[model samples]
Target: MNRKKSIAHKLLDAIGLFEIHKLIAKHINQHHADIVVDYDLSLLRSAHLIGAPKIGFFHFRPKRFRNGGTNKLRRIGERLKHYQKLVVLCDEMYEEACFVWPHLKDKLLVLPNPVDLDSLLKKSACSIDFPENLTPGEYFVSVARLTHQKNIHLLLRSFAKARELGCKWSLAIIGDGEDRVDLLDLSKKLGLEEAVYFLGYQTNPHPYLAKAGGFVMSSREEGFPVSLLEGMALGCPIISLACPTGPTDILQNGKLGKLISFTEDNPDELGLAMFEISNNAALRKNYAEESKLFSQNFSSQKIAHQLMSLLRDIASNQRP
Candidate 1:
């Protein structure tokens, strides 16, 4: 029944896409718009149907196999081909798209997501009704939707293992989603009800990241984990799964922080990584220093200009 509801929800979401895009198209027609900068991939078809020149920002990367990403590409092939240029968040994802749809090779461009460092860091200092037990520099933190894709289950279970191995680190995950109950149950099952804290969705999660001893991301997949970069900006040392399209570029292939392939990773391995990050002061300091350096690339002043320039160029071509 839950699965049926999930399918229905997705179907409704797809329908909503058409409805919303039609409205957007209607607005464009009303306003005499020149081009549509499409941010959501699901809306590409609508953007095309709207009869405006379309520039899509592609951020998702499904696993690349005949039955996987290829099939997804085929479903949207009509709208996909019509994009004036497909803006991807990173070079790696851009490369993957080019390989799948060679026809859109020239249309692909890499423009990573920008972060508001100053604003986020300020939020990191925000006074919130925090869990009283939480102490600055004593607990590891993560910010992700409580979902299978984000893999908080893996992080919880791994933290449990690390606990048994004599590490006394507490974990705080900030984000609310479908998997929260299941994760809480798992924490209880692992006897981590006390050690692990779920703060649910937070509007300003930076202060938690800023005060945290370190940050851990155990995601199974990602387009580009913006939360990972946010952690870096807040000076939180990190340990993350080397998922698609984000970590390598931001973490600089582990020069800035810990990155490993998590699908093949075991509880003990992840636990060990967590324990190491929590236990070592020197190592944490080094990663934090390197993280500060790496975060500058994603600063708002930087990527905002890149995106703006891309829009300017796209608009210029249509001029005259």
Candidate 2:
């Protein structure tokens, strides 16, 4: 009963939330001289239970429905007023949704999403074979869920155009979702069925990354793409839509890679850029170096230390 075990783990995780809340409450009580810390309130019932005058929200996603977001916002607003300190780690990784509820802006601390540098560096090699049918250096790699938000269609359209321009490039998309079938169909419709490969999800994509010549993203938006960071960390030349908050910041407003328009994208421009990058080995190497250097800012250890320092500062301020 693997399914039963999976179900059991889910049940345990759900139940453990209360235990974690209680433990945090206990710690707050024991350190009565300091502040309170609430992990995630979607599970915790009361702010008082966590016992901290200050709270840090990690990976907070505002609910979608109007009523839910409004209710959650009101609740958070109340807590913000009551709490001595309120900091939200709005890693804003997928903040396109936040465009709908712009009011949720001020509460965010905008921490960068962290990556384990050591682990990522360790995966600099790929084991997956370049199948006989595939041509080395003829494929572009994009690693993300096959979802509408990821704008897979734009990438497909761009690739199709690139192919029509006599550019020899295939696309290897790693990661799967409900959009897989539809995306496959879209590739076929665009006469790109043989040119694109959907490899589904891979727990370790570093191997694939190492063999890839470049990385691309057509997402409509993102806070900061971990995939982009990974590509940079692995020395793959990066390209992404000039989406909302993340990509531009990561690319330093096109300083790192080509940032194209999502609304009125010119495949001609994109294909030309790709064509140029394909031939320019020096430029590609330059981007690789830049990508690696840029990735250091998102290290997990650095974020953790910053978080600890912030917590200590809050705790000190809360000492009564």
Structural similarity to truth (TM-score) of each candidate: 0.86, 0.76
Query: For candidate 1, lDDT tens digit of each residue in 1-320?
Result: 33367888778887887788888768777866677777866565566666667788766772442235556766665567777888888767877777777777888888888989888877888898878898889898989888778888889878887788888878998999999989889899999888888898888888889899989888887888888898988789989887776887778888998886656347777888888888899999999988888899999999988888988888898777
Instruction: Give lDDT for model 1.
Output: 0.81
Predicted structure 2, TM vs. truth: 0.76
Candidate 1: Cα lDDT at 83: 78
lDDT of 2 at 133: 58
- What does candidate 2's lDDT look like per residue over 83-142, in tens digits? 443343333333533443345444445556688988887866646655565565556898
Q: Report the error of model 2 at residue 314, Å.
A: 1.1
Regions more than 4 Å wrong, model 2: 1-45, 58-76, 79-108, 133-138, 264-272
Candidate 1 segments exceeding 4 Å error: 1-27, 49-52, 62-72
On the 0 to 100 scale, the lDDT of residue 2 in model 1 is 39
Error of 1 at 289 (Å): 1.2
Highest TM-score, which number?
Answer: 1
lDDT of 2 at 94: 32
